[model samples]
Target chain A: MKTVLSIGVVLGAFYLLWMAAVPVMNIKWEVSQAQRAGVEVWLPESGIRAAGNWQLLSENLHLAAGTYAQEKPRLPSPVQVFAELWETTVEKKITSKRSLIFHAQVTLSATLLGFAMGTALGVVLAVGIVHLRVLDASVMPWAIASQTIPILAIAPMIIVVMNSVGITGLVPKAIISAYLSFFPVVVGMVKGLRSPDAMQMDLLRTYSASAGQVFWKLRLPAALPFLFPSLKVGIAAALVGAIVGELPTGAVAGLGARLLAGSYYGQTIQIWSALFGAAIVAACLVGLIGFAQTVVLRRMGMAR
Target chain B: MRANLNASKSASWAKDLNMIQPVIEANRLNLTFQTNDGPVHALKDVDLEIEKGDFVSFIGPSGCGKTTFLRVMADLEKPTSGTITVNGVSPEEARKSRAYGYVFQAAGLYPWRTIGGNIRLPLEIMGLSKSEQAERVARVLDLVELSGFEKKFPWQLSGGMQQRASIARALAFDADILLMDEPFGALDEIVRDRLNEQLLDLWARTGKTIGFVTHSIPEAVYLSTKIVVMSPRPGRITDIIESPLPKDRPLDIRDTPEFIAVAHRVREGLRAGHGDEV
Candidate 1:
């Protein structure tokens, strides 16, 4: 109930802001239309006739309706965006090219595949960093520096290079997601692998346990708590990476394509709906990771 | 002062019978840690011998290197000079052979594992059969009086119980020697006393050579057959006291005249070491 109320409050504030902007947008649109049409208007000042004032008010009302329902609005109204979302999602068949579900499926696949690859790379790098001094000194700084490069700046280059190498479609997008997701896993895993105190390490040493045995039995389990949270972050990063990967490719099958198409056609409502669709997909993915974290940690007896 | 109980007979038996061997031997063992502040002498010229089935306790204040000495025997720390042997072999070889079980200051039970699972950790590493692992886990859990609590996670148990579970883990492999570093230091007096009594009984039953490190005088006196008193700052042995108290001592035996006498000697030795500091 509280969440609902909070959401309602946010929506209420957005509606009020939209209502305020409507008149301003209307007047601006009218001025631009007049300028484009080269229309000159003369206004009578200090009018005492009630009929004239009523006529002005009616014209303003007509202008507000036209602003709110513009075919190519600069800022789409909430109701218009919602209607577009419903029409794209529920009105179309799941397999239809026009369906948001079909587009979401394309993005989700890339996100999941990239997330898996990224998680694997991160955990391996983390283990290496923790166990091997050379990697710890050399690779960790590079892994950190990789994240500083914005994904948008590199995504197109990556797509183009991969295309030259005969790699196209899903693989390039997944590569981008993996690139974004792997860093957190490496950072989290390294910390988790080293979480054991000196005494605990000594205890294992006393047992003469092999390094492999130590990793599997002690370090690995200790790293689980740290790994799950990183995975959540990685999955979210993977989603952003996947969408960004879609943007520069001129791809026509994913949510990114839908956004590009909306922008090209000045379909503000379509763009807003596509943005909302991506957000919802990311939330679901993160929620799934959180659920898995609870289950896995509980099985390990780390959680109640 | 050494009591030298039947030393002539034991010496003769060791020579003639060739059945008795020292479980641990340290000869002029020195370990200096190189730090940013310069070399810190953690252990200095430490010479000691622990015979088979001997319950020897190293008593000293903080930074006395008692724990370091135990770690050296466990091969967890390397000596800078001289040599130490466990089970008549180098510490490293002995460690590889799994000749001794070590209980650290903390319980060191993995929070992710249940008590039973924790105990089975060593057995699993040793590549024991699953059945054997389960059997040994049961036996050690029984020895530690934590039999019914096998399924409980370490966090679910009390502090004393967690320590007991750790002891069970150490005992799961049935090693001939046990090295404990202040395993009961964090417990209350009552729990410490109870654990002391239980440990003594466990020692008697297994006849394992035990090296215990502690700061408490009574704890050293009560649990050990031989007590080595140590001083800090270039940690070295100041005195070795052989307890006259019988092996079959009860908790109330702490109040007996012989127990009190031994405790008094331990206190005097500690004071002597402190006097040397001044």
Candidate 2:
């Protein structure tokens, strides 16, 4: 217990140091933008955006919350913005039915569906290219080329095309997610399937195992290490793709929609909060995938 | 030496060892491989017969078609002009029925599978029941002296241990014949000697017919009841030496005059097969 406590204190000190640096860093980037916008010198000569009360970490404390800091150059304190985080997430429910949690649930549903569809398609294509000689010859070149085409430019086109064809709402965004997510999986799985040496393949042939048996017994299991890292990348890409799809078409309810409103109305705090929210969401999803990787491999007795 | 097989053709091949009745008969076997430059004849008019429970080794120089012969028996490559029979059935028919096990120069183990799982692979493919597969795996693992390494990955083990695991895998399904191509070729000399002794012990205990291909003459002489010597660049069998050394061999047998004599004979046979003066 004492050892744990000591380590925790060290980590606490590091976090405090980090938070102390963050307000300045955030303001510096913002000030550069403000300067580019040709704003007059809004803050004091000291580059410190916080006035006098410069508490680094605690949400309850900051430069703006102090008395002497009132007349100095001002910026939103960590206290005020963090308080807004709690209010927007917990207290400010939409008719007590919808909040950040509800919005997260909605977005997660679409993201997961997209991830599943993307992974399945990727696996099928990889298997086709691996097993069918014609597909390997004809399809692989196009698959490589598809990844090079910018998905950001491609996402809007997909959304518009789907809208025209009478398929709209969640599907357009899901299609975009699949488009971005599958390439990594296909590439990873292909490398993995080919990873077995010639001797290993000969061993399978010696037993007269069918093609499917060779895949299930050898290739598929061997692909696991490559598959997991790619899934993490693919899931993150899926989230980014869903967000990009929202940008052009103007969807409501997702964090993307929240960003558009914030940017349009000059709600910098709200926009920042939404950006943080999206980061946290993506982190959680990737973390969940990592957790599953550990559990599944451990259960299969593949991992030590 | 089987100059006896060089039948005065026409009517004699039919009378030689009852012709079509041997367990494994390769008559006028030829395997041609087409490379970019031209067609290369890997095996030329090679003929041999292996009866039940015979331990045979094909030994020759580096470019000799010994390994090619083993590959042919496994039906991994089709012969250009010849017929091979495994128990009266064609090589392809026997392979489709999973009639034999093959061990390669490398262990060829899947790194993802543990030792036990690797051994269970052939059994799984043969569609044996779960309990049966596990039992057979345990039995063969014990046979190979790897009973405790069931859960260890191939990469975690030493090369010798991995090779032993592979040997266990081939034996786990109780296949009647084993086609091993330089199975201990990668091991250190000490390990190779140990595995050779163990392999002979295995052959004695199980009574499984073995067809091994090796470039080592002493190894072929030490383990085989019969050593077949071949030459390549026109791959054909030039000598078939029936070992007069007693079947129960030990490491100390190498120091004996008889073992040295057999080794001398194998070397001469290899040289003669390669068209070099012996």
Candidate 3:
């Protein structure tokens, strides 16, 4: 309850601040540009009618136009942005105005797919590397080194390489997410798999159980407590990878494309909205993985 | 079928009622480890035999190779030179045949599994069906007086209960021989005494041959039919004392003069092994 209230107050404050600041920032830019003689800028006045929702919040926050203020800003006010979100999200085809939701879906698809692939590959590699000394000595160093190269540098190269090889769209973005996200899963799972002590192994051995039985019964369950936390980290990393994958390519739809379109068209509202959407989506994805971990572990009788 | 059952019953019955071959026989068993310091002879040429239904124990100071001897018989360590036979088969063969079970000093229960799950582990490994495993688990839990603790994890249970669960694990597979390396050595006196009494009842009911290791003289005398006192620093057996106590179930065996006499002899054997005159 405390967290929810705090978050509401903070988000509310940010909205009000953004409402006042956007017009002021826009009006100043307009005047500077007007003086420069190169272009004209649009900015709303500081009055109750011009500030809009700031007018509704209180008179103390009311903004009257400064001497430098010009026409209304192109970007919507805070109330207008919320109205846009409500209209576009629930009523109108939101993405039709360069469709923010469609782009989010595109990025989300790549993020989810890449997260799945990366997590699967990472867990498999972790299990192999943890169990086998040869794999640890040979494969692990290279797997770790694979992550040292910056993802931004790798993103375009990945797109270019995939483009040359007839792969494009979601696959390229997912590959990028997988590339960035695999390391955390491997490291976390390796630690978890090795968590069982020698005595536990001997107990299994004394039962005359096979190596496979020991792993399935003992090591696998032991690894779970460590695995889920890493999965959350990996999923968030995967989303970042998807977004970064978008910046390089000339994609028409995705959170990245919406960001690019907003920047190009000077639609700061669209960019901020897309950024917020991306963050919320990433949080939800990570949260979903945690929920799955809880459910699966609870079913296995290891709720803690 | 009835005749075969009678024969099988008599086979185990031979240990108690008839002069039969020992259930476990270790002849001149020697083990030397290649250590950084030097080749340490962990076990000297040790000869021992344990009859079926024998509650035999090996008691000595630490580094006495009592544990090494147990490990040799369990086939956990390859002896430098030795021959160990359990139920007429070599130690290796007996291990492959799953003819014996082992318990370490600690409970050694899997932490992630429930107490009941730990007991069923060996049975599961041995490929028993689910129903058979369940039935055997219940029986063994009853044997250890842990019938209601089936679903509790090892950490949730008291140390004594966890140790009893481990005992259940050893007995679950129905192995004829049980090798215990000071199982009750870590428990408090009260819990240890309770476990010792229950262990005797288990031995009486199941007829499993037990070879235990402990430092407690009274515990050794209370539990074992024969106590093997050992001297350390390249361990050698100093004395093997046999008990002549009554076989009837009585909880006050410790207070009896006869039990006291047996315990006194065991103490003397231990003292002599420590190089003090008994």
DockQ of every predicted complex: 0.72, 0.44, 0.40
| Interface C-alpha RMSD per candidate, 1 decimal | 0.8, 2.1, 2.2
DockQ for candidate 2, please give it: 0.44
Q: Tens digits of per-residue lDDT for model 1 on A15-57?
A: 9998666555445455345446866522335432322533443
- Sorted by TM-score, highest first, which candidate order results? 1, 3, 2
Second chain alone, TM-score for each candidate: 0.92, 0.91, 0.90
**Against the correct fold, how does model 3 do in TM-score?**
0.82
- In candidate 3, position B160 carries an lDDT of 89
- Candidate 1 segments whose C-alpha is farther than 4 A from its true place: A1-27, A30-68, B1-19
Tens-digit lDDT track for model 3 on A1-304?
Answer: 9999999999999877876666545543344444468443333556323543333323322232432133235544665455545554567575575555667788999999999999999999998997788998988888879989999888999999999999988999999999888889999999999998876776675566788988888888899989999999999999999998998896788888877877887766677677777888988998899899989877666775
Model 1: per-residue lDDT, tens digit, B36-147? 9998888999999888889999998888889899999999989999989888889999999999899988898999999999999999999999999999999999999998
lDDT of 2 at B174: 83
**TM-score, one value per model:** 0.90, 0.81, 0.82
Local error of candidate 3 at residue A1 (angstroms): 4.7
Model 2, B49-142: lDDT tens digits are 9877788999887767888889888888899998888867888898888888899998988766789988999989889999998899889999
Error of 1 at A205 (Å): 1.3
- Compute the DockQ of candidate 3: 0.40
- Candidate 1's DockQ is 0.72
